[model samples]
Target: MVAPLKVGIAGLGTVGAEVVRLIEAQQSILSARCGRGIKVVAVTARNKSKKRGIDLRGIDWMKDPLAVATHPEVDCFVELMGGAGDPALSSISAALAAGKSVVTANKALVAKHGVKLATLAEKHGGALNYEAAVAGAVPVIKTIREGLSGTSINRVYGILNGTCNYILTRMEQEGLSFAECLKDAQRLGYAEAEPSFDVDGYDTAQKLAILASLAFGTKVNESAVSVEGISTIAAEDLRAAADLGYRIKLLGVAMRTKTGIEQRVHPTMVPLTSSIAQVMGVTNAVTIDGAGIAPITLVGPGAGGAATASAVLADVADVARNVRALPFAQPVAKLKTTTKAPMERHEGGYYIRLMARDLAGTAARIATRLAEQKISLESIVQKHPNGGLEPIDGTKKSSPVPVILITYATSEDAMRRALQAVQKDKVISGKPQVIRIEKN
Candidate 1:
């Protein structure tokens, strides 16, 4: 008889507890699939006495994460304590050093210390699986690392953060301000009290780094990603996007470019009919453009205990099946070094929302600056306070007027230079809101 795969899990928080319950509840299904039973032999958490609504009887309760990682009977160590540093890092390292397979849902750890950890796993002949680190329950890691390994991937982009997506969805659907939507998201448990990590695009950047490494055979480098958050996005931007046949989404995009692999996270203007724009709320989605094939998009619930645990258990099952794949889709030594791509050199269409000073020659000066930069406007609209549009006739109004400009494909440098001239020329009231238009 084949021995069951003994599992040790650290951190009995929401995700950890759910993992245990899932293993027990789906034991028969998992066993049938992996050709062996799966068992939770050991576990550890900060608080053992807390009521987690799951039974942990017969499971060895270790004193700490390191103990669980180094447990003699554990065949696989699952790290659910989410931080880029120890003891999650140390424990995962210890498990890999011990030749026990390691699974985790820590994107930050993977983003920061992935190469080091993968090197450890390689040296010790153990598997390092972090299917839950990026998009929860999406199976994107497996898709990119194994399923599409035969295909050449050119671009990978998506809405990776549920909190930001939820906030943006509310802002667009209810016409709420970013602050208002963020407050509601917090109250609904979709956002943390300190939501800067999610809203500021850092969360998406980390996930994008992981995906970029997998897709492009590069090392995971979060610092290489150019990041911009959704905090600056306003209700007006979303409304204007609707008027212009686009939807504003916070997207993390990594693509092959002439300069190198370009990784960026920001509020992007996606066409209304695109697959990514159809996604809303807390749901996460990733679209992969590969050579010799149509684009592949994976969509699912990105967070929550059940969704994350699903991915964690899937990684555990791969260990149970004795499936050992390279951690970053290749040996760490072969993974190329990634440098930060210059955002100024990025070429794309742009959406510029300017609060133009309603004075004579203001419109002409703005147009002249863009023209000097060789930027051609695809469309331009002067928005009235009540969501109406008037021609840009340089007509003075009671206050500053909202002028929306959609430019054809242009370099970020040109757009920046033009906007700077507009600002310096005192033709705009406040900073011009700029969102890059992503081509589908």
Candidate 2:
């Protein structure tokens, strides 16, 4: 029998530890499938004296994390020590510069600096495989890289942050406010103590940048992806959306057109019956649209230590078997420099909620504002008064009533202006809240 492939791992954290477990549990199956056994030859972490829930006595321990990348006994390098810089970045560069394959589950490293690192790997004949970077266990990178290889993907996007999803779903379903839901999520360990990155849409934006590169042949542009969080999403708004047969979700959405690309992360109104709407709680779902082939949807646990580790091992196995593909599934030189499409050019539907003075002239004024901007109202459902009875109608000047409406297909720029006009009108009482709707 051929000897096993030697692998070294850095950061014996949740994912690193899971990698060890998976290798042991699926050793026989993986060996048969790949024609060689994969073994852990070395490992590293800050605390070398710590017990990592499993026996690490057999593997060589590295004092400096970079040593694992260049270990003489190890043929493959696995970077579970995250962060887009420092030991992880320096070590991976050294390994690739020395012409060795690498496997990593770091999305920030890829989304922020994939192009430079990928160029290095390709230059030195080293494979930088990172299937685990985008969404844990979703294999989205693989699907786009291989399955949709020939199609012209307009754009790719999805719910990439599990922590945010849990919070939003809680707010939408339980009537809990964003802060309340976020607090609960953190207590449950779904969200970090400092949850800004996940809750404020930055995490999703980073993941979308990676997906955007795969969907469109563009260099990953993390800064270009616009982001809006659910912090300001009112509970009353969630309840009002449910009444209009919609569910509120923090969506990382991108689209490409003749004009340019529209990348946004915000609170969106997904149709109640849509497959994405049903993806509640901490779960994640990604939708890919191609010009020719059928639209593909991949859904599963977006994150977890083991879930992410499984993906890292999948990439390692592919490398051990000598199977490889482009880092962004295309040559670095082939990736088009992205042209950030302005949000004004974005064409889509919207859910608009406005509070109006209780009078007959109010709705007409809103309709006039929308018409002025070429936006048509698809449906208008005047919210019943907060109490048991509906607000009594009065044609003459009277109190203000909350009006909720959904707009037909229109440019985002137009809708923003129309909604702005409605909010500013003398007949309206408060600012209008608008949520973009994804029909698919």
Question: Best TM-score goes to which candidate?
Answer: 1
Error of 1 at 374 (Å): 0.8
What are the runs in model 2 whose C-alpha is more than 4 Å off?
A: 386-399
Which sections of candidate 1 miss by over 4 Å? Answer: none
The digit string of per-residue lDDT tens for model 1 on 275-318 reads 99999999999999999999999999999999999999999999
Write one digit per residue (lDDT tens) for candidate 2, span 1-440. 87888899998888899999899889999999999999998999999777778778799988877999999887789998889888889998888888888999988888878998899888988788888888898899888888788888975767788998898888877778888988899999999999999878998988888888888878999888888888888888888777777888888987877777778888888888877888888888898988976667789988999789878999989887888788888889998887556778777888876777765577788889989998877777666656222332443434666667787899988888887777777777767787888877
Pairs of residues clashing in candidate 2:
357-400, 358-399, 358-400
Q: What is the Cα-based lDDT of residue 314 in candidate 1?
A: 95
Q: lDDT, candidate 1, residue 223? A: 100
